[model samples]
Target: MSGSGNVHLRQMARQDVAAGMELVQAAGWNQTEADWNRFLDANSEGCFVAEAESTVCGTAATIIYGHQLAWIGMVLVHPDMRGRGIGTRLLRSAVEYLESRGPLVIKLDATPQGRPVYQRLGFEPEYEIERWKLTATPSLHSAPGAIPLDDDKPDIEDVIALDAEAFGASRSALLHSVHRDAPEFTAAISAEGRLLGYTFGRHGLHADHLGPWVAEDQEIARRLLETFLDRSTGRCLIVDCVKAHPFAATLLGSAGFEFSRPLTRMVRRAVQSGRRSGLVCAILGPEFG
Candidate 1:
């Protein structure tokens, strides 16, 4: 356990779910209980919480993908706990735990407030991703060419292969979790019955986030997005788009998704692979990145 003053850090337990959710919600983040479950489900030992006076005050989570890379996110400290060294302790705990597991690279998408802290910890900038939001669903005048993925009988290999090339890591299990949780939003755009592209997302309490969104071209990307938005109508939607891709900017901008904030993808002991901008329009989210 790590602590300073009254705040102390310890391995997060199943009973901490409600308190953990309160920390993230207080930060006005998009994560839900399901998101927290993703981390705990991935590795219960990898998540941590900070507490003071028997109350949770901060949290951090880590998820490793196929022993290749690990991502740290949902790093939060209650407003009352900021500047008390609680965030640092939680972040350090996450890094140390993952380092013990020996992933090639450790990464996280940092907000402006957290970028300097991560840089201080030796995380170098990799790329910029912007959170784009669509207040209202995009108009679906033309029928989408893509079809909803048959959740019961999906071509797992095809979906995994396409995502692996675009995402730079084989997160077949993560994709399976996303699809199983929200299969209605999982879709594919094909031509001549050949897989052109695919997309998957999860519903949050405040909004629905579309991510790990990949495509063969802009048209396929467009169709897949429309299908997701149509199902996600009446709810706030968010997509974290890579700034390097002009097509993503144009497509989202044209669809009325305004830029909200920027997240810098940072890595420690950086790896050369893992960025395929032409095919990857949006990422799975900072937590899963």
Candidate 2:
């Protein structure tokens, strides 16, 4: 761990979050310690920080969620460390680790500058989404069918089942970590207790922006969003959508959401699968990008 020493990329320690935050901010992303903790808790030991002679220099995190999908995010290198291969190596190490867990559908949200690096690594573009902003506070928009925040406790079992169904993999442990700090989590339901759609969010929790807003019915989905925003405070909300959640994205746009930054959802099918369409809707966490 000396200046002249080789690049040493390894798991991040809590102390690294402060140094890592500087690198993330300098890189122009609002990565905070809360975000780091969430990432660390999600896939324990999967958070990484690179250092040189007692100074933390680079950071990245890999989230292996619901089992099959693994995502890489918060990839940052100190301005001074850019010319070295630290960023690239840190990324590779993360991918290798996920690959070891089992088959994976690896994906990452790429900044314009990093897109080419990922493309070179065999990931193909799936879709691009604009991050929307809410210009003004709208009064709580709620409809009768929208469900209230349930379980003063997070529903581990239902969440596990629904999340697994959505992602097509089982990852309760990782999901358990996600449950720890969820402030607002809602499930859209009909007059009966059928699971129409659901949205879970954690504040001061990593991926602080909530989403994956889904409802079997588009209108119900929109109403759920209204309740979601009405209950929270932030200039806006952000979400990633695939073709399946057509109305979900449309509703956000209509509600004054604006693109703070948009990202390309890319994936490398380095693992085998029956088909991808089924799990596309459940790719919940932004960390999995």
Candidate 3:
């Protein structure tokens, strides 16, 4: 454990989930208790919490994607504790943990409010990502050609391979965890026995989130998204799309999604060539990416 005046930092424990949720909820974030558990389950040693007088006040978590990439997320500080440098400390701890693991890249999706802090810590902007929201009544019928993923599906391994190509890392564990959480919302598209695209959805505290949405083209992306909407009818839907993608924003706009917020994708070190691909229409989430 480390200390900064009255605030001290330590590895996050399962018991801290409720406190972590309180902080995210106060910030109006969409994370749930399950999300907290996901982080702890993936990297218990890398997630940290800050406490003041033994009460949790700040938190940060990191998940490494092989030795190639690592993501830092869920950085939250209680509103009452904002100016005390608790957030900076928490972030520093996360960085140190990731650096020790020697990943080639460390990345995070930064809100406007946190971008400056990230910049000061040597994170440079890579691209812009936008959150889009769709509100509509759920469709009663599933979109044709959108097949649900199952453990027995022969193409399941193909989906993971495709995701690794688009996302720039092998995150099979993360993908399987998401499917286990919401199997009904996960779908894939294939034709001629070849996988065309796939998507995974999460039931957030306030909305149904679609992401890590990948496809060979816009049409497949649309089909996957439509299937998610059909499965999660009458719920607010959120998608964090890659702004640089040729068709992502246009497809979302034509489908009646409205721009909700902006996020800057930042990296701590220069990215290697051929690590990522244009096939990623939307990211898993700022937290996961």
Candidate 4:
């Protein structure tokens, strides 16, 4: 444990999931209990929580993708405990723990309120991403070439390969976990059994999020999104899309998803090369990114 006063930091455990959810919920975040589970499952040793008088007051978790990179997320503190250094302490602990695994680069999507803190910690902007939402499902037409990716179809290895190319990190484990968790919303575009593009969805507390969405062309991207929207009708939906993508803004707007907020994708060290940002229409989520 590390802290002063009544606050102390410790490794998070499965039993702490509910308390973690409270912190996220108190912040009006879209994360669900399942999201909390993903963090703990991804790296239990990297998930840390701050407790004040034995109550969870803050949290910070990290997910390492091989030795090349690590993602810092869920750096949330209870509203009643803001400005008490709890958030900073939790973040520092997370970074320190992740650093112990070696000098892997750390990245996160920063909110306007949290960007300065990250900047002071040596993070620099990589690119901008935006959260778009659809409150009411729009009228849709089926795109000609889109196909359903069911449990029995689409080679998982191929999906991971494309995702790695687009995301610049091999997150096969994360992608597989997402498919296992919510396979109903998965779809792909293919020609002669060769994968061309794909998308996966997640069920969240606030809404259903569509992402890790990648495509080789605008039409494929549109079809993948259309498939998700058709299946996700009537539910609150969200997409954290790359602002620089040529088709992201237009596709979202045409589908009735309006701009919600802007997020800055920041890296702790210098930005690495090979990130195919253009092919990534939408990210899995800010937390995952």
Indicate which candidate wins on lDDT: 3
Candidate 1 residue-wise lDDT, 237-262, digit = tens: 89999999869878888777899999
TM-score of the candidate numbered 4? Answer: 0.94
| TM-score of candidate 3 versus the correct structure, residues matched by position | 0.92
- Structural similarity to truth (TM-score) of each candidate: 0.92, 0.80, 0.92, 0.94
Native-vs-model 2 lDDT?
A: 0.63
The segments of candidate 2 whose C-alpha lies over 4 angstroms from its true place after superposition are 1-6, 42-45, 139-156, 204-208, 234-236, 270-285
Candidate 3 clashing pairs, residues 3+ apart or interchain? 138-233, 138-234, 212-283, 212-284
- Candidate 2 lDDT over 92-139, as tens digits, reads 778788888888788887767677777877778876755554546544
The predicted structure with the larger lDDT, 2 or 3, is 3
lDDT at 180 for candidate 3? Answer: 88
Q: Return the candidate ranking by lDDT, descending.
A: 3, 4, 1, 2
lDDT of 4 by residue, 155-249 (tens): 87888888888888888888888888888777777788778888989988888899988888888888888888767745889999999999988
What are the runs in model 1 whose C-alpha is more than 4 Å off?
1-4, 141-154
lDDT of 3 by residue, 1-289 (tens): 2344678899999999999999988999998898888889898999999998888989999998877889999999888888778888899999999989875699999999889888989999999999998875434235564445543253657888888888888899888888889877778887778888888889999998999889899888877777776677457889999999999888788667889999999999877455557888999999998
C-alpha lDDT values of all predictions:
0.83, 0.63, 0.85, 0.84
Clashes of each: 0, 5, 4, 0
Q: Which residue pairs in candidate 1 collide?
A: none
Native-vs-model 3 lDDT? Answer: 0.85
